[model samples]
Target chain A: MPIPDHVLVVDDDPDIRTLVGRLLEKNGFRVSKVADGKGLQQLLEKSQPDLIVLDLMLPDEDGLVLCRNLRSRSNVPVIILSARGEDMDRIIGLEMGADDYLGKPFHPRELLARVKSVLRRARSLPGDVQEQDANATYRFAGWMLDVPTRQLYSPKSKKIFLSGGEFALLRVFLNHPNRVLSRDQLLDFSHGREIEPFDRTIDMQVSRLRRRLGDDPKKPSLIKTVRSSGYVLAVRVDRGGESHGSDDSGPGD
Target chain B: MGVEPDKIVVQIDEDLAEIAPGYLENRRNDLKHLPLALAEGDFYNLRILGHRMKGSGAGYGFDGISEIGRAIEEAAKQENRQGVEQGIADLAAYLDRLEVIYA
Candidate 1:
């Protein structure tokens, strides 16, 4: 029998850790549970997990810090589990290099599906095969997005890490820069879901993105906001190398 | 607008109500240090704690508490220490009212 893929779950709450660990284990993934970021770091040193399910409320450290640290070292996918159901937390979690964010009180089935989707995407890509083709690097406003490594580099060659949501949002914006996109349009493109018109979640996310880009909300140079409408990426985009994996691949590969 | 004189009772779960006072008190104490942090322009910690309190308060069904937390959060981001302090006071008042209602 083939060995199941390994998953590391880091949560401070014992009940949550156990619940999530059991849920993943029952879904055929070998699961390891840790109560804090320190334990998670130790586990990562000993064994490379196929995917990580991290909690944002670690007693020792913020999960976003750990996620960014882990991303700087490895391409391992990270899914953040947060009790904060607010859109800000989700947006920030995604902006911090997490592959996905699952709010607390989430259906176990949804968590399982997210894990499966993330694992499938991670495994789909061939490791250590860096494509040197022209389409490998995508450029926008002195920024370079490396498709295979899933890393963004600034004009000075400094790496700009993106959370899963930011990456997806950026991808959609790049695909249709200069076009005024409604929240619904952007949501559909990025998350494949229908959002309520009254939901300011998309607006909060755009504000977060603008902050990361250092674009002033008052005078956005890159992502312009249409009053009472949606957003439009004002910057010019230059597509470099083609992205690896299929177009239908799950995010944060 | 005067809040209802009769104790504004909510049918919160036993566990939630049991923990509500302590949580609110602890968060109120934490708010004291937030101003110092804000003065130093360290909004990250403020935002983090504010976001946490907002989530926890709402989860415990303290809608007023969560609203105050959100207000404090926005004020801190804007560097309005006075606004944050006012928010903290408002939260304390809300907590007092809640205590009376639950008492």
Candidate 2:
């Protein structure tokens, strides 16, 4: 028999972990379950799983941070499971490089489908293709986004570093420059998730991203808020290798 | 029949305090049938509600409310009518204190 694809399930709740692990294992995937980020790290060291099923809530560390760390080092596919039904959670998860997001009280069958879909995508992408794409960096507003290394560069001051959320949110904004994106739309396009009512998590993330972009929320530039609507990228974005002609000029003249 | 001075003084967390009033108001509307359940001796349903209250109340950092929920669950399980009534009264008093805290 062929070796089954390995999957890592990270969740603090034993019931959920067991239920999910068993369901995946029964579906022919070799499964390993961990309770927290530390355990996940340990598991990763022991073996490279084909994909990861990660829970946003862990007893020791937030799953977002873990996802960010994982993305920085590897391109392993990740699916986030969050009890928070808010759309912001989904967006943030996707923004942080998660391949998919599933809310709690989810059907076991749905989770399996998502896992299969991500795996299929991963398999379809030829090995080293992501690395080659990453080498082709994009520059906008004096900021350079290194895709493979998963790092950002500030050309003016020569600074480099962007948290996972910052990188993902920036990617979405740059890709859709000058578009008025509602929080829900931002979360959906950026992370493949929805925003929950009465949740300000997305606003918090956007503020964080703005700080990285050197855009002040009080005296805004670059990413501007559309009062009672959403946000829009106010500057032009030029990907690397694109013509550096008139359209590719830097912002603020 | 009289209020117990020491009936679990539940304190609301600062984060939850701002929205507690609105949340409690909505809960009160949904909980209109709660008293009817208690009066009809539907301890099972009461226990279920108590369990939910225990989890969320504790999660939001209200230990006293969770304790009262636990007490209510225990009392209902034992079929202690007076204890159940006392638990309900304590819960109400805690809610009142929360209102005062927010006020």
Off-target runs (Cα >4 Å) in candidate 1 are A127-129, A132-253, B1-103
Candidate 2 backbone collisions, by pair: A86-A196, A87-A194, A87-A195, A87-A196, A88-A195, A134-A148
Q: DockQ for each candidate? A: 0.04, 0.02
lDDT for A231 in candidate 2 is 77
Candidate 2, residues B10-103, lDDT tens digits: the string is: 4544544544455455335425655777889998867755544443344344555557767776787787778777877877767666522432
List where candidate 2 sits over 4 angstroms from the true fold.
A127-253, B1-103
TM-score of every model? 0.40, 0.40
Per-residue lDDT of A1-253 in model 1, one digit per residue for the tens?
Answer: 2235789998765545655676677678899989998999899887878799988878899888999899888888999988666799889888888989987655567888999888656534422222222235667777777666768887788887776677667666666555556686677665532233354478877887777777787877777776566777766666664322212111110
Per-prediction fnat: 0.03, 0.00
- Which model scores highest in DockQ? 1
Model 1: lDDT of residue A82? 80
Alpha-carbon deviation at A65 in model 2, angstroms: 0.6
Tens-digit lDDT track for model 2 on A173-237? 66555555668656655453223334536688788888887787787777777777677776656
| Model 2: CAPRI class | incorrect
| Deviation from truth (RMSD, Å), model 1 | 19.3
Q: What is the TM-score of chain A alone in each candidate?
A: 0.51, 0.52
